[model samples]
Target: MPSIMIADRDPNERTGIGWLVSSCAIPYEKVLSAGTMAEVFQLMESQTPDVICLELDMVGKGQWDRLKLLVDQYRPTVLVTTAEATFERAMQGIELNARDLWVKPQTPEYIRRVLTRCCQDQSYRMQMSQETTGVTGRAGEVSYLDLFFPRPLHGRTYPIMLAQLEDPKHHPELLRFFEDYPFRDKPVLLPLGDVIVGVFPDDTHEPQTLFHQTGKRLLMDWEAMSDAPLFLVMYDSKEREQSLNEKYLDAIQALHIRFFKGYRQLTIVERQVNWTMIDPFLTPSEQRLWVDMLHGGDPEVLKQWMYRHFSYKEEPYPEPGLLRIRLTSILAQVRRYMKSHGLDNGDLEQEYHRVFETILYSPILYRIVAEMLLFIQRLMDLVQNQREEVRVDVIEQAIRYMERRFTDSGLRLEDVARHVDRSPAYFSTLLTQKQGTSFRQLLTSLRVKEAQRLLLETSLSVGEIAERSGFVNANYFSKIFKEKTGTTPRLLRNQKKR
Candidate 1:
């Protein structure tokens, strides 16, 4: 049984969570509760629980820092619970390496599930640690590789499937060996096969040796197929586990392992991947289309084939003109489609696949596809605002733009676009793209702001100021002005004079 701790500020919240945990009947040996960060620290000193549930907005401002300290010291699996569903908070939770995030007002089932998952994960980690310590006695002697399948195989026979994967021009060297060997596919060969069994490793190894040894083991295990190879595939990079399965390895191989280093290590697994679809040597535009398709979720196999044929790295093929423009335009359309649909970060990978599949075969739609992906990615980045200073700068730029030109008569999108050195359409798209609001809203805000300034600083009639501040019609201006100011412009002006 695992030990658990809950830290939250509200008494009712603490009671609610305590009751939920009890009701769920989770196997916790001891459950500790703390209302404040200080109490949490004190509780930690006494007992180190297997799991920690933190309220993101608990008690005070320095709670996160304290939480970090607790996490570092105890190294428990942490789950953050918060009422605020903001990107910043979400990112902070991510940065803290929290096991998961739970929204407040969570249902009993949801809480139960999260706790169970965390505990199970903790148990798995403990088991793996023990295994790594060589308690099972198979650490260095056995080789392991994970195999994943995107879809269920058509048949149960591994040999037939290996043959399907081995078409030399299509599959990699590992797959090709199975294709070239005929006797290895005999039914009699299948019965004697301890030759290829999937093994899961408890310990992590250096990439080169891991891949090399695992490959050698598969070939050695099967007698007739001495040259046959094995590989590991990782499904989602987000999994905390060290070794990836075989299916993910197939995907990576299909991508042709485009970017290679002395030893493959990724800083941020998502961004650092120079996916097979992206040709490093292609023109920016061509590269853009490939990148968009990659993010859009182009099939790993097809992308690998394309990389093999079209990638600039595979020299001697003449570069195609207009590839960049085509890719950019397509990406722009994708961006628009995503925006109108209200999709979020979780949807990005799936949507990328959907959008790319929609345009992959098209001959002239490359630019549109590339632009759309770039647009979507930029929007995602803006929405997430991973860096605090970046978010502040973007907000400040919009505020400053409004403040400087609130009183200008022709304060249309085109004017702002020109100031920003973008087309009106592009600027409008950018504003909606970045701020999640339209230009009209921003402009109206600016006008209403000036209305307040006039009411407070100068003795001008509401109508007089409304017309001067770029409101064409007085009545329409008053309606908007009053809606924004929370009172009629006339009353505001009168109140100021009095």
Candidate 2:
């Protein structure tokens, strides 16, 4: 029987996650929850759990150091639960032996799938550890001597199947599964650490069922267990060529094909000569849909919109060169959108090559698409610099409009905004930010300045000054002028004579 432990600082998360994991009924001997590192240590001393659902946020203090110590000491299958999970964090969580990391807001179903995989892995490792001594492979290579019996003395050309690992971490489980594969009686699978190879001369006595046996056996029940796709290249020695070495060469060519075209169904090197590339797929109908979004100037929303276009249904399987070309076509849409915002296409080819090269370097199809989408996002983010230039011009125009019309007593904020071709609310905010005051306050200050100038520089009476300065009446002018300069308008004119 296996055991499970849940460790987290948050009580709600500890209990909630524990309850959900237990609901899966993963055949555990014990299920314990820990709120602190002290409790985690205590439970670990009593019985080191077979599986640990660890919350990285609860690790606290030393963070990665503490987590490393726990992982090294216990050697438990650790499933990390983090509030924030990025690609880098997930990469850090991948240990050579046992660790699965997931982010929060995950459904019970996803948790169950990960937990099931962990338990199955842990159980397989424990069983294999005792049964096979030299079978534990090194990181880089595998020893063929410890793996299989010395090559059959009746050396004849045998069929070979080659598959590149989706994740090299799954090598041990895959190798172990191949050891007792219920498919063929005499087939021997050689685990090369990074690659899995199968030799079939076992059923050659049945000659007709020779090549079809391995492919047909794998198609049943294997796909459901491993959602991760592998680059599978299977070759037939009896059907195609006379030499086993030639068939092995064909397997190698097929693997290289996967590196370029991206992984899909069984690839036959013998059958796939003269395969044509996909036609240029620049769908003009969908051009406006993506262009308007880039001009709208939110890279994050544009990225999400791009993500919706991705699906596994890439029919008439595309070549690596064709896929790269498709990526460039999508990027050209962004460039077209940028041109409207004053981006020059002068060094566009150099810029396009840099991003296109980066997209091609992605190992998987979805990853290639994701990298291109992120590039488009960064491209759209550059539009903010242009937007900044436009904003300054609009604010300057609004300020000048206010200065020329301040003496008009019936001046309204709406009319000023309309003069500058902006909404009243937007113009008001820009004016307040730029001039440091509201429309009404600036208008009053301008009128008072004119009243003060007439008192000092002209022989104008208080009532006459008020009429010319855009005040409603002489009494209102006196009240406002006295409030502004702390003296009546008539008194200021008399004082100036002294």
Candidate 3:
């Protein structure tokens, strides 16, 4: 008859879990409860339970080590419960070989479902062990022996390489790439969840060179089979005292650099590379420069800007997070340009947001940069078409006329309509329909933009600046500026000065 223990600080919780377990209909002959860590330890010492529902958050660090020892000793089916499911807590659960980590406030159905699955898993494992007592070996035996053992075969130090697929879903297929790879001394392939760690024999002459050569060949060949990219991190040799597990960990840590280096190639894991400090946000001056570049309508300059920032591989590289934030800042500028050109609609807007997400979440820096370039090029194409259309486009011609004469104190919708060879009311409707803003609103925006430029660049008086920005009354200009910019002209100028 199997027994289970429910360990929590609360009596009600222990009783509730016990009742839920009984309701699960599993053949648990005994249901034990422990309201404290010491009680948990005492119950374990008395007679180790087959299953333990442990509240890991209640266990102190010192008691945790002792509890882990007990767990390792008895090999109980542990279902860890915690107040918060953090990465650290999840890792601790993994160390205890926990069947699953359930966060607190779990529903009855979820707890019952988890309990049933874990109980069945325990039974299956026991059955397997009993049946396989006399069996010789099984698949992944090489992985077991190499990773678990403290030392490798004496006098033979094999090189370790860890391959991580670009897409985690394709990890299982990666094992096949190494298993059939034509190495002189075929490497022992080990599947480590989303990573495959291989230990290659150092038998051939210049084995280091040969290992690198084979890694390249495998990269090219694997891509032929699957479209997903692969990243390989290799260590030439391990320390005399280092075990294969340590080497595996080292390679895994080194694999993180792949975010900066990119995929579909081999990287020799030699030394630690630190990320240099960087300010991710663009300065006001830099923002203005980007606006000028976009207004200049040259995509090559933007392409150069992309390459200048991203293509450099000098150590130490800027942190990936910082670069991502910087990319988002640039994307904000691109978004404004899209909106200004009436491109932020339908598929173009969707593609813009897609590019935004890629900049935020894409694993590879090169991939992010490539996607950004493609988006910018697409926008540039649209801008070129807009430029050609401007020659015959009534709305475009009207907008250009407004841009030229916005500084004139007497400039109005009628003047722009006359320039574009259309009636004032008809052009006003067309402008509002195409630009998504009224004629008065659009003219105000143009004038305010000029005012901002003058305020920031020149040391002109408020009244003088208002006249230059096409406002007859300085007080009305101040009110309109405050309404449009959220600040007074003098205050904005003062902010710039400071």
Candidate 4:
């Protein structure tokens, strides 16, 4: 006969949560609903519930302290809901000892699972407390959780497993997995900041192959629960001069090998980690080779080069930090290619920045390589498309060059002709023949159009706008502007204001 309370600002959300809770198999004697903080407090004061579901957004700043006090006093299993899935909200849940924090609009199945898990946890804790009332702990008796610090080893050795997430910042989230692990005799689960160390009992005598199989099973189970990659390093401690703490450190060092081996697979470390020496920076010759390949624009050749250098794995692997540095060297050449092709701005620039960050922070080499290959394919496609478009019309190419440099006050017919690989005289004659306008006339029209746009949109003075629009002489610019638009720059701006 457990009682539960559901609190939210919206009536629909409150009813939805109540329905989901009722649909769960756990039988509840009372299902209370509250739409305000005052109502929630009234319900809690009147009837002590076994569980509480609260929306954090509706809780005002003044109510936080009182709510936290009530929660600590009643000690109900609390599940908080939030509109924003941010770290601050999560920290608030941790402060109230909430079992879970659900973002708004969660699926019914997920909500049910969370509620069931919280209820189960509450029941288990109550049962354990009752069973250990008189036989809790004698003086000087050490608990298994104390194994994290320096302790007496007595020259004993035990099999240990170091479980770590690909990104160690998520170590707190990993604790839930060990809470309901299926092990018959649960091992001592120790959290050492970035990694979780499980120290098995001394009676364990599993073979190396069996230990590896168990590690794989645990990894598969974790993958089923979370998408983040987990690295589980197993080591059977042979009676050596090292303490349990030292063995744990050795396993942590072994995790670096995943930089080469990739993640989502169990690793069995038999000995110390060994890293070979390597020059992380590219040599002058390699830089030249990268430039040549980029210029060649052959995807097959670039693919072969990537596979040959990065995909081939050998013993005594290079240090991961150094390999990351070398990857940046390759990116340097790619950046130059992008700049040469005018791909250094807008979406292409953002894509390049993403690849740069992935190279620096991605946990596995295979993922970095995969992202780089995809970016390279996009770059090659864009380059080929630009080449085909330019080949279709030389006059279009000349016009594009002029459009890009029209803001430069010193730009002339020779510059556009050189960009399209034609002499000044030939280019001028071709321009008039195609567009029925002289080069100077076309350039002036482009500049005047830009000046008119600036007049309408910006607050700049007439002289400043004229200079920005590639007009050196203010008087000439004013005459041309009037001729083109039939109004002065100041008059146009004043008319728009009216």
Candidate 5:
């Protein structure tokens, strides 16, 4: 049985959810409801439900900060429900780590399915916790073990490395031997027998002793101490499936190692090998990819693998260019995926293009990564650094230029593009690529924003604001303004006055 909490402002909506849960016979021990953000947090503290279904629109302005705090503290699987499901709204939900999003007019069956999935997910997490002994322990105490499948051990057909350090024959004698050894607690140890393992002990105990003796032997054999290390790389979507399906896994497995699959991600285990011995298996392009993946941890063997693999290739230019091309293609694919899934606004496409351009032209791979990170950081720093460099600078400029000239009545995008020193077609493509919105939409938004500012910040009447903002007719402006803002300009002005 799962406990569920519903956070919706409408009384009818709360009642509707209550009835749905009851009809499903979900074995819900408690069904708590709240109509405001404050109530939601209060109820959350008191009830501590297994799941939280939040109404996206009902949340008041600036409530996301408090919502995120509650989410972090409780760690409940959140399901966001909203009447208006836009890419911006969906992205907000994703940022908050909401597990799923449901729109209004949802069928009872759909609601039941979502709740069931949430329950199943919770059960799976609990089961994994029991199996892995709660992965949230101190890093030192957490034993880092690597399962390596060097040359397909024992003719096992499955592509997995199952190495356990608990084997008695190899580890027991070593543990006993280390009982009186010095340097027991100063340094970490890498143990090797049939498998490789890195042990960091929590206490001055036998496990530490075993690690010292066994780690030395393993290092002597492989000439290195760390166990398998995994790296996660996020690339563009189209090439992602192909990259994952193609060289990404094969390259890591070429070292005869184990890896785990994740959504558009891979975790690779660290391998210990002589630099001179394994330098024959990587191309320059492959080397860059490996380095990119190794950013999370120091998998130096991967660098050695790259060096060895590319030793025979005399040409250096093609490899880096190829790597950049592959990365750019991946980024483009990711943008397409985001658009198709309605996960982001169209602006991502333009941002992706800019990132791709910057990365491709950069002299070094590390520099490219640094610049990309800085761009993302700038975009995220919207509250401060009011005019900071962002991935969307080009689009922002276009929007500003349009807003300044929109009152001209006969203002055209071509004229705007000329002012920006770009061709009309190129500017159009850029706008569409970055804004995800068409030229008409940009123009309309500029007018709407201006209308809103005038209504809220000035004493101008609605009709006057509409005319000054470039609408041919005041009535049409009022209609479009209401459509965009969900409030008539006159009403908005009245509210501002009060």
Candidate 6:
């Protein structure tokens, strides 16, 4: 099927060229147009037509490299069309292997003749190329791996597919697939029994056709092999350059979505992922409750949380990318949770990586969820377990503040709360809850203890001791002292002397 794309900034010129191409004798399978270079690169991912009618005038000063890159990779029959042209630019186009240079507003007859000729020439060139390269048999087929992989060619995007078999027993046969894909389209393969990454020329290939043909080949050779359910994620790195490892990470992230859905023959980019994806299992209220529970230590609530995340469901599959996004969000929460609890994040990050890889390859969603939830639960457990220690520290600090400030008659619960930055009511509640005593009782105990210390350690008179211990006078101090210790200050001093 013949195809053509018109690249032009002017809509009128694009319309004119499209009308001419339509009226041309060759019936194009795809007649496309791009107003910018980005759109041109985007369109090339799925469809690299036999002919690309390029508008030279629209190419920005910095875009010459991008133009040269297109020529280097796809080698479409480039018809350099511009309203204004130059000898230097025309020669440049010729050097880059552009088929011809033509002025814009081309007549129907001229477009018809030139386009037909270009498509014919391209077909002839491909036939010669395949023969010259000796790619006739299955055994001798060339993979982009032979030319690319360790060293990637510049100015070309590679479409990568990561395929993981749900069953690992089929791994041995799948490993053989790593060396060479069982297809006419030689996909550069990286083999992991549970994970396989396949790469194809981004410019000249579409993911669906490539994966389909590969799947077909595998079926024909294996001879009633197990259902061999494959979970796959396909994408092209056309927008930006990325390393093979980075591409693999993208696939793994994509694989995270596999936890929500059953096996798919092919899973291309069909769904979007966002925060709402985890709503079915964990909602906003649940998130807040979990945060609260981390402090409160609700074991039953924690059990319910694990149940929802790890529970199995046959119907109502979640969206494919949601699981990965949710997992990522959970990991972030873990870090924040650790930070809030005054814990280091380094160990958690390393632990998360270990668990994350396992999560991706786990056979059941229950295991993956269990692994992640365990990590989250471990962090939450740290917070929960520290609840007592934290409470003790707060109560102890409040007691010290009371002892230091008791002599100041103006001292009040609000003053103590202000020092510790807690509301008076909250500080008071915490004191009773943690110490089994109220603020007034604790304050009085501190004053009596200080009065005893004065009687034993120094010869301070009862009146002076009363003033220092925050009581108004010796009488009031003695009265409170008897109530607390069953003795008067004068009697305590006399006993200490004895």
Candidate with top TM-score is: 4
Candidate 5's C-alpha lDDT?
A: 0.56
Top lDDT prediction, candidate number: 4
Model 6: CA > 4 A from native: 1-322, 329-344, 496-498
lDDT of 2 at 93: 66
Q: Which ten residues in a row have the lowest lDDT in candidate 3?
A: 132-141
Off by over 4 Å in 4: 1-152, 166-174, 192-194, 204-206, 220-229, 312-314, 396-498
**Candidate 1 on 373-445: residue-level lDDT in tens?**
4545555444454444554555557557867876776777776666656677866766786788888898888
Residue pairs with colliding backbones in model 6 are 257-320
TM-score of each: 0.27, 0.44, 0.44, 0.49, 0.28, 0.42
lDDT of 4 by residue, 51-149 (tens): 999999999999998788667545688989999999989999999898888998899988888877777776775565445332122322234433445
Off by over 4 Å in 1: 134-498
Tens-place lDDT digits, model 5, residues 273-391: 11222222345675566435433233344335434432332211234445556545434433443454343545655676678787666434544554554443433343233323432
lDDT by residue for model 3 (233-330), tens = 87766345566666666676678778787888778755344567799998999899999988888889988988887885645677778888999999
Candidate 1 TM-score, C-alpha based: 0.27
Number of the candidate with higher TM-score, 2 or 6: 2
Off by over 4 Å in 3: 1-158, 166-173, 182-186, 200-229, 240-246, 256-262, 313-316, 340-343, 380-498
Model 4 residue 103 lDDT score: 92
Q: What are the per-residue Cα lDDT tens digits for candidate 6 across 1-498? A: 667888888888779877766666465777898999888765653476668887777777787776665455455778887776678778767866878888755676777788888767767766655554322335333353433344443445556667777776876666675444323334566565467666654444444544444444353344344567666677555544554445555656666556655564445542223223444244677567667765565556666866776564543456544564565555555566677877756887688777877655555566666677677677767776687687788888878888779997678899888887889899899988888988888888888898899988999889999999899888888899999999888888889778
lDDT by residue (291-379, candidate 2, tens digit) is: 76777777777667656644445333556566666766777786676577666455544665666776666666666666667666666
Clashes of 6: 1
Query: Using alpha carbons, what is the TM-score of model 5?
Result: 0.28
Q: After superposition, how far is residue 433 of candidate 4 from its true place, in Å?
A: 20
lDDT of 2: 0.65
Clashing pairs in 3: none
Q: How much is the lDDT of residue 465 in candidate 3?
A: 95
Residue 244 lDDT, candidate 5, scale 0-100:
19
Sorted by lDDT (best first), the order is 4, 3, 6, 2, 5, 1
